[model samples]
Target: MKSPSPGRSSAVRSMRSAPFFTPIRVVFSFAGPSARRPLSFFSPTIRPSAWRGRPWKALRLVPLLSQNFKAEVVAVLMLILFFSWCYCSYVLGCWRLNIALSWFWWRHLDAGLHAVMHGDFRTRHDIQAGLFWIYSLLSHRAMEYYYGARELKGNGMSKHWWHHIYPNDPGRDPDWSTMTGVAWVRRHTSAQWHPCHQWQCWYWLPVSMFLEPLFELIQVACALLEAVASLLEPPMNGPYVSRWAHVLGFLCEVLFNPGFQLVAFGVQPFWKALGVLLLARATSRLLLYPFSEVQHYMPEHILNREAADDSAEWVIGQLLCTANLEFRNRWAWLMDFLMFHGDSHQIEHHLWPAMSFVQYTKASQVVRATCARLRLPYYTVGYFEGYQKICEQVKEHRKPPPRPKRPRSPGEEPSPSESSSTRTRRRTRGS
Candidate 1:
């Protein structure tokens, strides 16, 4: 075999050190006698390096927990506890609780709107007249339930209706890939709001708000009835079955109540459910518009038109398409969470969508470093600061004054000094 050039030998050695290309380097090393001297000299050191050692050690340890019966039992117990708490909290409303609460108010507003539209303006105050305290309590409960269900569904790892209803199903696999499902939703449904586009109608807003309160109150009443009924039933034998029942209870609270609210009061209520929905929509647009522009609209990150394959590029595309929300102010963090702060750890979520929110922050530092190496945008802004900027951009886009087109002159000649002055002005403006 011919001797390899020194540059080629160095390049091969470098490629071998890289994690993914290591196997290729090993193959090349064995194929050429000229590769042996450099390989033997450098390969031993590379193979035993701490960088290589830690990952291999960690990989080896993963199966040990499964192999040991005691460890497996402990793992299962921990998993049960974790999921149980998640289910209870989801049913009880730890996330987006305000939305559920506002459902009651939405019902009232919806009713009033309907009454007004039907030329019953006198009924406007009637919805709130006798129902103030009841509506308020139901609203709070509904908000709690709404946020709880959202968190439960998000944490459940499945986008399916069945999974939302019975999340703790032992047969249910929580690690199913969300990319395809999320992509389908993004393509078929609006990213900023629910898949149903009916909420966009302006007239429905008041009606929804008016009727939501009453609808939510009925849901709460039904839930209490179901709980009392469950208590009267024979106790479930298996732990899984009991867990499933608890999950079902939460599902009942979330779906049955809200489901009835939508169906009985009609879909018109969502249109008039203005307070929380409006705030949520406005907050989301403010956060996402600039975010989308920076991550997707920018020339550097835009998806290629000619490339039919969206495989490897899509992963990179996600990293490029999302930016981190860095909060400088303490209040910004609270506000961010209130308005989809899950977005702050976006890159990590994209990389490992199944990971719990608790794990996301831990993974963020590593993900950020990886993104930095790739030269992708890792956007971080103080919560309110970013929100304010996005609002400003929206206002700018909305402001109307069309620029007049400059008229073209036929064979216009400019003096050298005039041209130089214009060039200077153009350069200054460009800078």
Candidate 2:
């Protein structure tokens, strides 16, 4: 048999290095809080990197001393979470909140990370990627418990309960208002013709990785303050009291918010720990945000209208507004998890927020066929292609045309200079 060509070998090598094509790189690309490092450390001595070296060694007797450690930490996590959900609902107001954006990575994801910290870089990468894959799948599945059955059972009245029933109202879609990434953009719905949006296709990887966290800092302050307040609040409407709970919780959140949970739990120094965590988050966001943020912004979606109006039928509204992404590749689910089922088949999600990511794909086919049969619009594109469209649309909107150059008179002849230029042009063409 003939040996494979040299060009094919080089092509295979190129594919591995091209980060977008690498499943491991793509999944870990957003290893921020969602990567879910531990909440607190039992041992202040063991380096998290070292924990990966020997997790058994890192498990000291400290956890045994505090029976309530898990409970306290879990409660704090819940507080930050609850405050966030409440805040988003508050901002979007009652008009536009169908569901949580699947944003929070549960405490168990962190717990599992702690348990499996012993591994090589590759092993740890797989663990972080794998853990989210499993947990998000489960969390979204559990969404049915809250949103009702997978079949879209009942349209309960409460804001949280009926999310799947009415997923993507321009006024009622939480995603447009609170999805994540840069505030005042993407998640924050605003009339925008910023040059940044125009050039996002070019600037996304760098600007997103570095600048986004600062934009997210406002959220950090809110979470920490809420934790602080919860700590200070008088239980059962009693008087205020200072306590260790308030201080410790505030400290943990402040330290932990910028991917410092590893610092709290493991052996890394503050700067080193933060630097490493930031790098991972930056890498993750670089790969993740453009696609995630651009979903609703795609040119044809027309989601940025200044005022709400009669949208299409609720299901058609989802298709009209949400960008359907390609994720049929074998490892695309990891990317799906990073993005919280993201734009990758987002229509399937909006139409049936109750469906698991797996089910979303199956359902997308049926939805697509139905849309085709009914002659409805279904916006599907490659993730990068979708972002390109958003940038172009933003650019198009930003540029106001030159005052439509006052129309030339119908019978007007050219000026002497214009006639000379026209003759010159004709001579050049003749040549």
Candidate 3:
């Protein structure tokens, strides 16, 4: 036989090296380089291989629901449950529980009674602190795992990890974030009232102990009922109740109970409950306002500010004025997670909002490194420490000492620089 041509020999060698030298390869081998023109088109075929076959199948289910009445019914049911849970946990559970519990505790106390009435800060601290811990422990593990898995799968960059990872259809992009009503309220209020709002202290102090409890109680009852209903009924495995009942339950147990308890017990005078309620409403605005300032108000942190110019700018502006409390202590971490770790992780969450708690630690490490490189402050501390700092600032602002005018040096004129230096010295002296 004639010796194989060099091209043929090379093709034979390539065939041996290739993983699947099937009929297609043989056909291509005979077609020569001119046929290679079409091979480039086949490259995209490999891209689909990266996704497991199941992901595509799973993704196909998204569009099925939009076509018929059954799907719409299911969708509506899911939405209702979601709204109910949100209302119950946040509004009634957190706000109401705080007021109820606080009122209960306060009824028996003297006029001078306070959270510190139990001798030390332990009683009041325990209530908030315990709630925070419980919330963190129950929710953090699952949330972290869910979030971490998304990060590992290259889907952790978005705000709502669940919807993105398992998108219902082609119409929606895989990485979209949705804001609930409460979240919206929190964001808008915080953004509108920081730094420039001199009434922040007056707003937050009393409200936390009164009006918030009533709303919170409504949330709590709703959550409790939903959870109980879930346990009694064979889980509908519906979109709303199946996946999120635990979230509602956790919120009720952690946030609602303590907040309400604090309100009831922390404040005194049964008649003052009205004042406390008004204060609670104002403080709700204050807490949310500062929170929004830091997250939604700030330009860098605002999610979709460009679309809604006013809202976006408002959020960015809030972040600029508001400060974050970074918790570092293990206990503090536990407490914050329990009470509403979201508040504690505000800065980091804004920085890498999609990362799960597990991945958040790693993401936070990277964040710390980046912040260090940029010479920016990374405010991470213990929960208690952060809370203490806020309290101190509030207290200081509320009862600021009258600034005494500087005594003019005998026969010497007071200069602007000298006055500033004197003020600075005084401010720092005790602080």
Output the lDDT of residue 197, model 2. Answer: 56
Best-fitting candidate, measured by TM-score? 2
lDDT of 2 by residue, 1-431 (tens): 11122221222233235543333223122222211211111112312331232222322211212122332333235446544643443333321221222123323333222222211012123333343333323232222232233222223322332233334444454444443333323322344334455454455456566676545555655755675566556666432332333344345434433232323225445565445445545654555445555654443344523222444333444456666767557676554543333346667655443222333555666666666766777776776675576555444544422355556699998789889999999999999
TM-score of each: 0.30, 0.45, 0.28
User: lDDT, candidate 2, residue 345?
Assistant: 66
State the C-alpha lDDT per candidate: 0.35, 0.40, 0.34
**Residue lDDT tens for model 1, 212-290:** 4345446656865674465556656323343344444344333323222322123334444334344433333333443
Tell me how far the alpha carbon of residue 101 in candidate 3 is from the true structure, in angstroms, after superposition: 12
Tens digit of per-residue lDDT, candidate 3, span 1-431: 01112232222334334454332222222233312221111121322332234322322121101122331232234334433543543345444543333322122121111111111112132332232233322232232222232123223232233322222211232221222122211212222223423554565545444555556657755865675565555545433433353544344334333233223333345445444444444444444433322232232222332333333332222222223556556775543332222345544443222222222343455545554664544544443544454555444444323468988879897699988998999999979
lDDT comparing candidate 3 with the true structure: 0.34
Off by over 4 Å in 2: 1-172, 178-189, 192-205, 215-222, 235-266, 303-312, 333-343, 397-431
TM-score of 1: 0.30
Give candidate 1's error at residue 110 in angstroms.
23
